[model samples]
Target: MKPQHLLAAATLVLATTAFAAGDPHDHAHAHTPLHGGVVVEVKDIDYELVAQPSVIQLHLRDHGKPADVSNATARLTLLTGTEKQEVVLKPAGDKLEATGSFKVAPGSKAVAVVTVAGKPSTVRFVLK
Candidate 1:
């Protein structure tokens, strides 16, 4: 084969390999919760939050396994129409939970600020 043709083929092969290596095809945001809650991802960590009429719970997982949040603190903000309320969540076993009467409707939206090891991350959810 000609040297120029060989060089072109090698360049194509290298480019393809590099592109495949950098491709984010893992679908990181497509997480199905084990507890049937709303799931969101932050920094590759999955947070599943369940909202009820008078209670809220947050479950943290790392790669589908339960994660410990004993050293973490969380605050939840709920918005419905023009009213907004916030609640503080304390670590409870394998999850973070809070008890308070809340107004959660079909169009309500929630934002959770989770602080683990002193670093804070936010997750948002809009109810269907």
Candidate 2:
């Protein structure tokens, strides 16, 4: 290929790669688990689920800041093998919490349907 043609092709490839990489600043919005639980993000909000034998907690955060769960409610479905358990969580302090005898073990899965300000979002997690 001619020199000019090769230069144009290289520039195009570089531009495409950069565009596909997305904005570097977007890393600031990445979600991380805060309560030593599994975290999933939906609609720019982070939901962390902490599953324990005696209690379950769901923590919410937006842009790394604690989100208000004062009026929010969540319904969690816990799956362990063929046994499924359901629990309703209500706002308690800065997180949604429910207390009961739960079956939480390694490799258990849970799905949380959370509602905040009339908007509902679903978050799924696999316990470790």
Candidate 3:
């Protein structure tokens, strides 16, 4: 391979590694599995924690899921400036929803806490 190609490839890999939030076990924002019917295609996903409603809504492009997340529970931790806010989630039918005690403002770092089949699970996502 040409030197330039190798350099570009290395930089691409480094960029992806550098942006990772934290160590896998250190944070709740971990890998999330695609459950339900046909996994929906979510693009430019946005997340928010509304303290008053005790709910976190995952806003993304409408896609089809094979099943519903009605029985799922969502947990969330908002990380920003060394601050972490923890929240619990409940199923909101199609969307895996959760309510949090902390009022996370817009553009906060967030991790999706999805409780699947009564077992505590998580989905990692950055609030954008």
lDDT of each: 0.87, 0.91, 0.49
User: By summed lDDT, which 10 consecutive residues of candidate 3 come out lowest?
Assistant: 36-45
Which pairs of residues have clashing backbones in candidate 1? none
Estimate the overall C-alpha local distance difference test score of candidate 3: 0.49
Taking the tens digit of each residue's C-alpha lDDT, what string does model 2 give over 1-128? 99999999999999999999995545576577879998888877889999999999999998788999999999999999999999999999999999999999989999999999999998999999
Instruction: Identify the leading candidate in terms of lDDT.
Output: 2
25-125: candidate 1 lDDT, tens digit per residue: 46654588777688887877889988888878999987677887999999889999999998999999999999879888877999999999899999998
Among residues 3 or more apart in sequence or in different chains, the pairs in candidate 3 whose N, CA or C atoms overlap within 3 Å are 36-67, 37-66, 37-67, 38-66, 54-99, 55-99, 73-115, 74-89, 75-113, 89-98
Q: Which stretches of candidate 3 lie over 4 Å from their true place?
A: 1-54, 59-63, 99-101, 105-107, 118-121
Q: Clash number for every model? A: 0, 0, 10
State, as a TM-score between 0 and 1, how close model 3 is to the true structure.
0.43
What pairs collide in candidate 2?
A: none
Ranking, lDDT, top scorer first:
2, 1, 3
lDDT winner, 1 or 3: 1
Instruction: Candidate 1: list runs displaced more than 4 Å.
Output: 1-30
Q: Could you list the CA RMSD of all candidates, in the order they appear?
A: 6.4, 4.6, 10.4
